[model samples]
Target: MKKFPEHFLWGAATSAPQSEGHGSLNGKSPSTWDKWYEINPEKFQKNQGPEHTSNMYENYIEDAKRMNDIHMNSFRTSIAWTRLLPDGKTINPEAVTFYRNYFHELHSNGVKPIINLFHFDMPWWLMEKGGWESRESVDAFAFYAETCFELFGDLVEYWTTFNEPMVHVECGYLYGYHYPAIHDLKKAVQVAFHTIMAHTMAVKAFKAGKYSGKIGIILNVSPCYPKSHSTEDLRAAELADLLNTKSFLDPAVLGIFPQKLIECLADNQLLPKVEVQDLHLIQMNPVDFIGMNYYQPRRVQAPATVNHPAVSPADFYEHYDWPDKKINPYRGWEIYPEALYDVAMMIKDQYNNIPWFVSENGMGVADEERFMDQTGMIQDDYRIEFMIEHLQQLHKGIEAGSNCFGYHTWTFVDCWSWLNGYNNRYGFYRLDLENDQRTLKKSGIWFKELIDRNGLL
Candidate 1:
């Protein structure tokens, strides 16, 4: 095979809450997603809703078999904290048993399991207690991490402490894009600090437990592109890069936060309140691998002049501008596939040859029309093309000497997106919302063939 290395892993990624529907009866506590929909169902595209949707909770055996048929060497999925520890204190063995059996099913087919600890799903009980903002939530997260290692570390070889920490900080705290939408940069900084400390603690706890597995932090890394040659634009891009990527990348992998980030926080007088030895703890415990969920690159430009001055984040900095870019007609996220090459090379040159994997990468389209041929499969050509371009970039990364371990596309099956609801379809296997049934898209069938051969013919 000219594509993948002999030891390289090929997998598909999914999170528990997004795929394992049946939350209503599955003993799953209300996650942030649950509460968000409850608060503003109208915000979701087309008034589409979120509930027990995918039914993976009940149909994992079929899913596993399908993955096996597709020759998936590995599978990436998250453990919903709420699904396991609904009250944030009590452990749910039923949920534990369910996952154990699912991993057992995957292993039976020789599929490597990469389990993430959190993927934007926090128990509403914890959110009620102020979620990550409160120190108690940090302790709660540590306890959950420890419990997970004790329970399922043996079957799983990969443990990702989080899936995109910056999204939680920017969306949930500063921009109010995600759940518990608040508009305070101070709170954002505090939450970001606690999350770093929590990841550090999780790594320490994982190693202390003597689990023979690789642990890492997942980041949605977007390489910033300056709009023009203007100095202001370049500085804006730098700030965006530090805030969006390095804030988590540096501390998690390099054992220290970036100096530029430290200065930026201090300049705003919004430096987070930290415990006595938080910095020491973060600098001491480093991760084993870096998980990347790349969708699109962000282009930054100088801030537009604000007409009104108020006590708000708008007073802080500026918007991003991409002077030249390719566009993804389906979603507005720029279709700059070359950035994947740039991302991989940037990591190799900057991050000390750390082992990394593409945790998630896929295109989200508005409405993928159903395709049923004589052989019974849905056709999704765009998704396959998306994978081909990105994977070629990944292959180029490997050629450039990046220690890339795997390339897992964004998802296996179409599931509920956070705010977009069911508007965007990003899956190899198409999930029919009308019937709650699963059908292998033509891309899914084609992927099976490609993986069996290790690449497209």
Candidate 2:
């Protein structure tokens, strides 16, 4: 049998936009997602929009109970910037009251709340202000962080500044997927730089206020594995890791950017405009810790051609599709549990063993109703196996001396995913979209036992 550390945090992660509905209610301003869905409904699958999600805004009381029932000690969710400041600057009294009550409910039910400040749900007003491409938005985000710390600082002990910010850079600026979609290398680099600057600014504010709680950032730290041991392959993998993984991790954890990454940008003429003291601020405001969201490993090979009309990461490396790779057919993600151990060791060996945790890991299955039994509960045995396999690897890393403290699944309930909506379900409790009902799935029952034992046998 293997066991995690005492006081191990066992919970699931959710986001404000994905789980909390009431997009426009209670004096809430429109978020980028709301406006994007309104303008381009056809872009979303099944014409689903962000108007009505899992309704967590109204069902938080019972949702907290569900978390406690499963012995989940810590849960991570974001505070909607749109809700907190409806107009992007003025505080909304109604939103403050609602969030106050929701955090109180979690505490009353014996679940500790881990509140994240931003989860890519930018306020519509902020978006119109040039979003991350402008430094003024960075100041706005720092102000938002300070406001959150003051408003709910007493309620939350664990605070995160941003969640998977790289996604915002890639999906919105590089790829045409997320809201405010644009494909420009210059904008992408600028967005990445401003995003990190925003994080450091938030960290500076958090430290300056002398908040009792710890503040950090959540990054999707997917390790890049080379297809072969050849020099070209290894170099390609390193570049991929530099661009995708360490670009944010180094700045947040180590208070510096990778020199190689800087050189890459300089050589390509894609360097973002930087202020004279921006690097100093980043160097001074390292996070207290970090949250890592690992779902798949990136396999890369040296690109055959480096010629391009404009600078792009694709010119440096190409994705290598390994034959016979175990994959999650539903989500189209590779299922490589060993990558968990690799990520843990990377943090231990390369990043001075910073305090971190698995913030998001789960299996998303499509049309989960097919697994429901006669009792109307989802028999998600696959999810159980997935977590167990990943946990086993994580336990190995812990025993070998990784400063990991927790393991949070991707979600607690079936929340609405971006574009995909609720088609891919990843939750311990199945949420009935029709009636806003939540039923504990088989994985939830198994997880309770695992939490009680504090180990796997």
Candidate 3:
């Protein structure tokens, strides 16, 4: 253990839909994600659906107490669009009260609450109105953001506009992870443009509200690594980085879309439809801080074949990789701890050292129940190792002068994943979905000690 910053926020992060059960608690509406779940239940790994367990909107006070048990200094939970603005045209005060009280409870218990505006949960009403495709939706999103800042900004000091804009593009357009799934390059370009515009708009609203708080965007920056020094490989890696990470990072923080990205879109005539004033707002309004969610480094390599079955030549894959990368056996995602170092350093150098936080990072293990064995609790040692390694890398970057201010793991409790649903557990406290019982795993106890020790090696 080591002493770091006196105000370091060591905590856990979760989203409204992922942790909040969709159907129960009088919260009803077809979110883009919910519709996706209904249409393709088989898409999930074990027939697990989003209908079951999400810790909030169901067991708020108890779960808040569970988070207290883990001894976290902070907690990050997203405000669901469909929940807050159930019909997209109006605000739901009841929903707002539920969330307001939740945060008030956390604050009362000494946990700082970082509220994020969006987490890929688009209201179905908006989706039907062409979702992020129409510029009108951008206006609607901006208004909704202002409403949130007015209502909650007084108590919650940190506001995040969107979580993982790249994943939003990939899921909604390029790949079919979530709803309004489309694979058209033209549509993808439009959607990316709108998402950035929405983030920029949110920043504007936050500043306009005159709220005394840090307003920023949460980017799931999967640091890109090339396979080799070969020119093509390096080029491929850069393209991937531009598409996945830099697409939003540059514009929202740096206040300009990556030129390479703009050129790529222009070359294919897939350039998004932009209005006269949208560019101005994006360029002038930059975030006060950045919230990053890094689960793993993205290792891409040269496309095996040209003209992907899903995307055209314009949508080709960029080759990138870290040689001899370790794999998180349980989650099946590549484990490159050093990427966190590289990402932090790059953010300092690349984004001008904006204050940042590891808003979400954790390993997703399967059948964690088996780890209990004869004991009553599950001993998730692998998750402990994964987190420690990442933290070590983070410490290295911090020592080297990166302005990373905090670390919050993916979740505080074992809860529902998107399509994977309740199957993938990523919490320090494992929740029995069947009985709604909470048990502290070894990682939970370890995190408490880490909080007390101030740091861990």
Candidate 4:
């Protein structure tokens, strides 16, 4: 039998914007998500916006009790910037009180809280001032992060500056899939740069404040695989890794950007305007650890023809669909359990074996009601098998000396997904949208057994 290390953190992750309803109540200002939903309700599935989420704001005490029942030792969630600092400067007392109560409840329930400062839910006020595109917004974010540390540092031990920061730049700036939808490559590069600046600044603030906690960033490090052994295909995969994986991973871990990525941006004249001091600050403040969120591997091949002026990541490499690839039919994402092992080894070999954890990993299925048994419990055996396969690979990585300390699924309960809304559910607890109630699925029960045993045979 394989055994996990002692004191491994077991839990799930959710963000405030996705799980907390009441967008504009309790002195909270609107975030970009709220404003976007108001303007384009049809963009979200079933027209379900961010208004009627899982209602965690009102049910956090019960939710924490549920987490205790599942034997979860830790949980990750983000603080809504708009909720804490409505206008980006003034503090909201009601928001602070609610968060303190929530964190205290979790602690009382034997669960540790891993607090993330930002999770793509940019404040609408900051967006009005050019969001992350402007240096002003970056400084404001650092201030907000410092405030969070000051307020909750006594209760929390782990802090993350941002959650998957690159996704916002890519989806919102380059791909038009998220809020502030625009297809501007120049703005995307600028947003990515300022985001790293904001993160390092926050890390600097944390150290200056002398907080007693480990600060880090969460990255979705999907390994890039070449479609074939040809030189062109290998080069394509390399570029994909530079853009998607190392773009943020390098700076957070090594306190610098990859040289090749810098050259690529400079050659294409897509480099953002920079101040010398910002680069110095980035070089000085490296994170203490990182969180790795992996779902699928990126399979890439050389593009048929590179654009005369490269405008997007796709200009260099195009996605390659692997033959006979296993997939999650409901979410349309390829299922590759081996990728977990690859991600683990990559962090060990290339990142100096930095301390990290599986921050988000799970399968999202649509309409889980069909799988409910007569007793009203969901017999989600498929989710159990998925977890087993991935955990086996993670165990192999740990045996090979990856410095991973924990595993966290995508979510604790069924909550709002960005544009997909509640179309796909990725949770151990089934949430009734009609009424704010949660019930554990079979996978949740199996996970408790895994936690009790500390491993699998």
Report RMSD (Å) for each prediction in the order shown.
2.1, 0.9, 2.1, 0.8
Model 3's alpha-carbon lDDT is 0.81
Q: How close is candidate 2 to the true structure, as a TM-score?
A: 0.99
Candidate 3: which stretches are off by over 4 Å? 22-28, 45-47, 304-315, 318-323
Per-candidate local distance difference test? 0.83, 0.92, 0.81, 0.92
Model 4, range 1-457, lDDT digits (tens) per residue?
A: 7799999998999999999887889998989899998999999999988886999999999999999998999999989999999998899999999999999999999999999999989999889989998899778999999999999999999999989998999999988988789998889999999999999989999999999989999999889999999999999999999998899999889888999999988888888899979777888999888999988889999999787569888887999999989999998889999999999999899999999999999999999999999999999998989889999999999999999999999889998998999999989999999898898999999988888888986
**lDDT at residue 436 of model 1 (Cα atoms):** 71
Q: 20-78 in candidate 3: lDDT tens per residue?
A: 77543455567776777677778876776666665567688887787787778799988
Which scores better on TM-score, 2 or 3?
2
213-308: candidate 2 lDDT, tens digit per residue = 898999998889899999999999998999998899999888899999998888788889999999999999998888999899899999988854
CA error at residue 327 for candidate 2, angstroms: 0.7
Ranking by lDDT: 4, 2, 1, 3
Task: Point out the higher-scoring one by TM-score: 1 or 4.
Answer: 4
Candidate 3: Cα lDDT at 349: 95
TM-score, each model? 0.95, 0.99, 0.95, 0.99
Ten-residue region with minimum lDDT total, candidate 1: 307-316
lDDT of 4 at 44: 92
lDDT of 4 at 119: 90
